[model samples]
Target: SQQGEEDPQALSIQEGENATMNCSYKTSINNLQWYRQNSGRGLVHLILIRSNEREKHSGRLRVTLDTSKKSSSLLITASRAADTASYFCAVLYMEYGNKLVFGAGTILRVKS
Candidate 1:
């Protein structure tokens, strides 16, 4: 079974705005990671927050995790046309070793 599922299947926003995406999981996790993928390309690692960490930030990206609720959110600040991509949340199941289960992802379009 898929451990994580992202909300807002699709989103459209203008440049310079902020885009927020959410994910919910079905099981306990050791850690959760966010990834970004451009059109027709492989995914790039964005950020990872441990089950014990409430939040983390990298560059223009911010991620928050709530293990108690089995949920997480990703925020992209100052959105740009190049930021248009699909965002995914992957969960590292606590009982599944190092395997990461990925969500369906949220397609974000940033119009300039």
Candidate 2:
């Protein structure tokens, strides 16, 4: 079962702006990964934060995980039109044999 669910199913932003998307999960997770997918294209790995970590960053992307709240948020700074895509949060459950479950995703549209 998919453990994560992203909020604000859709978002629209202007270029150079910042976009934030959040995800909430039901059970515990060993790690949480965020991915981006262009229309009709495969998902691209964005960033991942381990259970022991509170936050992780890569380039203009930042991810924060809160095991106590069972939630996470992804922040994209200085967004560009190229950043337009669907963002998904995948949860890896250690107890489930490291099974990864993905949320429905949040559609992001960055306009120039």
Candidate that would win on lDDT: 1
The lDDT for every candidate, in the order shown, is 0.94, 0.93
Error of 2 at 69 (Å): 0.6
Taking all chains together, each candidate's TM-score versus the true structure is 0.96, 0.96
> Clashes in each model (backbone N, CA, C under 3 Å)?
0, 0
Sequence-dependent TM-score of model 1 = 0.96
Q: In model 1, which residue pairs have backbone atoms overlapping below 3 Å?
A: none
- For residues 1-112, write the lDDT of model 1, one tens digit per residue: 7658899999999999999999999888889999999999999999999999999999999999988889999999999999999999999998888899999999999999
Off by over 4 Å in 1: none
Instruction: State how far residue 17 of model 1 sits from its true place (Å).
Output: 0.9
RMSD of 2: 0.9
Q: Report the number of the highest-TM-score candidate.
A: 1
Candidate 1 contains a number of clashing pairs equal to 0
